[model samples]
Target: MSWFSPSRLVPSRLVPSLPPYSGPYPVGSCDVELSAADLPSPGSPPPNAPATIAFRLFYPAAGSGPSRPIRWLPSPQKAHFAAYARFLGAGSLLSTAVSLAPNVLYYTTIPARRNAPLLHPPGPAWPVLVFSHGLAGSRNAYSALLGELASHGIIVVAPEHRDGSAPMAFVRAPDGGASTSVSYQIHPHKPTAEVYAARDAQVRIRGWEIGVLYAALEKIGEGAEMRNLDPNLGVGGVEEDVLGSFVGRLDLRPGRVAWAGHSFGAATVVTVVKSAYYGGEEMGGPFIPARDAGIVRQITKSSVLALLDMWALPLTSPSAEQFFEKQLPAYEPGGAGGKAVLSVLSEAFWRWHGNLNDTKVVLAPRTAVSDDDEKVEQERRGPYIFYPEASAHLSQSDFGILFPWITGRVLKATEPERYLRLNVRAILQVLRENGTVVAGYSPLEGEEPLDGGGEGKKGGDWRILNPEGGVRGWLPVDMEVTSEDRRMSIGEETGGRNDEVRETEVLGDVKL
Candidate 1:
């Protein structure tokens, strides 16, 4: 824990390495796509989907041993890049022209060692975190951010959801049969009945996948038999039991395991928390733990929540809106309170006044009368919320870092790594405050410390959730703003361009 601090973080001069993690720990990662047969889905699988779950686990490595670099894209490189080309509408099914664009970039690599040994920290147990990706995203898409978190000593699991949200994924059968290509199921972002039904179906599938992952973690903790369905897990050679190395390592205590997501994935986290923690609501209650074997008790009120640029439309979809209108699970008795929840919104998302307002409802604390005293029903301090000025929704993921040239030239994303560092700083502080033993220091904007000196010049003081614009471009959201001003401020803040139409609800989660 006494090594490489934020100030001392050295960026990988090499192009393939992701932005170097600021935390003191070295990171390792592995791919795991397991059969859902024994894990069992609580509900019917999403229409035309397989009974499988997939993800990449990034964690603090045990030793500085010789390691293999994790590819930014999984194997069958050109095919995966072609899917991205198709998803971006840059190419038709047979358009080799556009497909070649990502092909040129397919060789880029993640900054983690492949299937390296998991670090055994000098603590009771290593904390664990589960992260979900957004629309058109896979487990590899967010490796930079997740690896940053893992570099701080937590085991981070990024689930690859096959509910038609991904651009394209290869789903291998439970018995290691032929893999089937599952393409993205694009739906209208409008709040129409059909769209709601489509998204509601996705949430169910995603919730079930998360539950199954927790079950896998339980077995991995006990050194039980489990199979990783990733076709490329043993591509080079089987050096060791990477899956078995996780035995008795992860901390699964109630609230100890954190949950996070971005955009549509973030909406899934909101619904999953409600579905798993507070069943019996309008949605017929508790969908994930339908049977006793789910082992989702770890998903309690105390579990930490980190949501980034959460797309609000899915939460308001026709089916589960009623269930989630209530407070988040963190507000329950023995709950972790507002500090347990952190939402790092992007400036682009902030311009979408309506969506921003919806985000507030999801993160803000609601008041209720207690019959006699009229006391507050929720914690006075709401979730920690902020936005790094000039950032886009893609800033929180590896997209900006991976495609800095295109993003900078076209999307106008500058200093993408700085945005990611800001996110990691906030998240690490959140974990440390929650009783998880991590690095003791996360320097603020105007402060000088070890690891060298002042690296972040503006807004990293996560402790004071409401810095009221004191932290320069890192603007703390004023939850009390009026809806009228909210709409007008979108133009005011972003110079009237409203550059991002989706955050404005026009494009929605569609990257294009």
Candidate 2:
């Protein structure tokens, strides 16, 4: 009878909930794919074909309508996940189970309407955010965060990279054939240079895709005919209708646009920004082809950039040098007004990478100022580093929040509400600095002062480091005083040790 109870081994209820959005407007979502024909392929000889880029758009909707059921994992994506699991050495049984029933472990419905009407009389077109997903991650993995942004009147366009970085992507043929899912293969034990080469190539293709999208948006703003600009775009797919709805509704104003990414995607953001400012070949090296200089200049001149826990900046090689030296210069304080940059890092990143020793050494010298410098000269010029104490690398995405039980094996469980509040606050600060929309709700209103003077340390577990004095000058926050050696002891209280008693006793002082 006990053996028949398999429910004890495998819990029936595993679906996780997404944190509710704290915004004013309803959210809507749509998907689109754009194709650019006869793009130059540097390494490949002749017969280079066109490039196709897929994107998912999340935006504010007109009214509160019946929400569409968003699939947690689409059919093709499930296959990709299975392949990815196997590639990462997950057991075959677990991989097959995950592939067969992804919906069983996660909530299937996303809180967004599909193809809902865009808010009409559009009170000023919404600001744009171009998001890049991490390697092997699809556009929908960050749906929770993207939906929240959209609800706050920010249009989020997430591009799905097709350069063998994504686990799988649907590639449509020009000859009207059915779309096919191409699963990217990962070569085992590749050399460091080869890995960097592959990543560089992928990032270049992503940059081009972004340039093409920006060009299309500019044309749309100029009221050019969409079909005439590219015949292959918005045709023969479900995305066609969605792309049609975006005409005349995008806000392409300079400085209002933002580019954000996580992990490898963050490297892409840095590369794109640097390439746009400097020449592509100069910033990305000889392996990378130059982009349209005009388009690159237009996009980079006024975009807010956010890098979410970027993995190893060195992965981009020469481009990484450009990012640290020329792109993110620390001597010029006024540069903030031009390209406002924000970097959000998790505690796990610091712990695993020895408190970011390499990064600190690279950035410290560039930001050091003279001790006798004037007040105005001492103003911070570099990116603000936001460190959330209880977070991990995956904290920026829904994966950590949704599957806490599984993720907790590697990292401590995060308080989703606290995490969201910290993220939203940091993002709002960057937006305000960039002169974008300011949040109606403020996080600093009723909070105690960060300095240790006010009512103790009750605010939160996060810190912001300014680059003016480099890593050594990290601002201090109120810290709670606690006993060091408070150990729990269990003892038998009753005669002859009949009953157990537990007590906590304080010993010597201990620093956390």
Candidate 3:
């Protein structure tokens, strides 16, 4: 008689002990913001000085019928034993108590929601898509997309790239060493005159934080250095060393993962793709000499379903040059080399000063306002007429989705729905062809605001990015995109640019 039982191969318990947590969900759909307090400066205060890095999880609604929720096959007893060891290390004496605890694994850490196991009868495990948010924004930004994916029977795990997010708080021991009780805190910049000063700081922080998350996931489930605190610690203060070890421990069964981001978050995704961090296409060309197994392998193994970038386009292209020239006059070199040279300064100064005002023109208002606008009976006449151009165009890309309020404020007016549709389609096409799960959310074309709505509403621009396009199922967008026909629009900033000559700022001098 076979004493061994086939049933022993699978663990009896299937449901995660943790209860589905639905804390106070923030009102409105996906959106981002920047204020004067977030601006960057040469001296003064530290970056993210008053910002918080945070995120939220959105699980798919329950599925029905035969095709049930996927389950991890032949659950590894060793992994469970290791988790038990970690629980012991954390100093809980009741071993049985810990084991018996309901919702132990899922609820033990964050009060987050998880989808029901296997939507129907037991089936194959669902593919997992991981998301990272834009700079200064939290994981919560992607809730709309994540929730949508979950509804379709996909399991999504969105980790807070803490460093990439707003400043976070952690616990430390008496000796100032990090303790396990680290709790997160949000220190938003105090509201002031400036719009967004810390944009770059948030970007840099996001880059480092994504790197940590990638490294951590890559190491999950491999007991090599299991003793280190990490994805294991109930709190969030794991050292890089510990994090690296934890990622190495992951049971990342082959051929089932993809990566994505929004706005600056999308840039992070590009970095991961460009560096081949999560396994993608080869990073070839002048800037990057070689390729890696990260994104390339991820695509090959996991089949990146889609790369959903909100209206974000590469900055190096000629279209971007035309866009800058046509939109921001102060950005024009006024014979300042090519448009690239001027745009760099424009971005930097925007990061620093948080507004559009030339020093020379400040002393001489005539130079700021064009002779044409002066002749016309316009109340405000300046080099560039702050219309809904840049923000309108930028919002079509991921930038708008990440910072909607800023986009609306900068652009001044909301645009049409067709524009939003075009961008969302572009992003969806790129990600799907690359072999990853993806979705692009945008506002409906020609959407009207309520009586009290429009530009005056706080975070109104956010509506433009996530318009009510009513959940369109995953129909992949056609790719063959190019910049030939679509010339960048020349906003009111035209004319006066020819007369002004501002010194160009070199790329090396600009901070990342």
lDDT per residue as tens, model 2, 1-512: 23322244434355555765667778777665555552222222112223555677788777554444555454454565565565434443324434555655433446677766566424566677888887666677778778887776677888877765666677666456676665664632222566556555666566666666666556555555543211222212223234445566677764457888876677676666655655544454422434543345455444677766665433335545555455343224544432266666665554433224333322222444566765424343345565666665666777666656544544563664455555655565566556676334432421323544222332221223223322221322211112221111011112221111000000000112
* Model 2 stretches with alpha carbons more than 4 Å out: 1-14, 38-50, 75-78, 91-107, 120-123, 187-191, 220-245, 280-294, 300-302, 313-324, 329-334, 337-339, 358-380, 442-512
Q: Model 2: clashing residue pairs?
A: 484-510
Q: Write the per-residue lDDT of candidate 1 for residues 322-408, one digit (tens) a residue.
A: 665677877655567787899988887877776777788778665544645322333435788899887777777776776565556
| Whole-model alpha-carbon lDDT for candidate 1 | 0.69
Ranking by lDDT: 1, 2, 3
Q: Estimate each model's TM-score.
A: 0.84, 0.73, 0.36
Off by more than 4 A, model 1: 1-17, 40-49, 91-103, 231-236, 285-288, 291-296, 368-378, 442-470, 481-500, 503-512
The regions of model 3 sitting more than 4 angstroms off are 1-124, 163-205, 221-256, 277-512
lDDT of 3 by residue, 1-512 (tens): 12222234323243232122121221111111111122222122233332322223243333222221111110233343343334233333223333454233321111232222222212333345566653333343234345444443344555554442322222223233543221222223222222122333333344434443333334332332322222221213222222221222232454345555543354444443333322112322111212332223342222232233221222222322322123211122231111110011112122221112221121111223455643321222221111122223233232233334443454432432233343333333333333334332223322344223433442222232232322232122211112431222112123343212111110011111
* Selected candidate, larger TM-score, 2 vs 3: 2
Q: Report the C-alpha displacement of residue 121, candidate 3, in angstroms.
A: 9.5
User: Could you say which candidate leads in lDDT?
Assistant: 1
lDDT of 2 at 254: 48
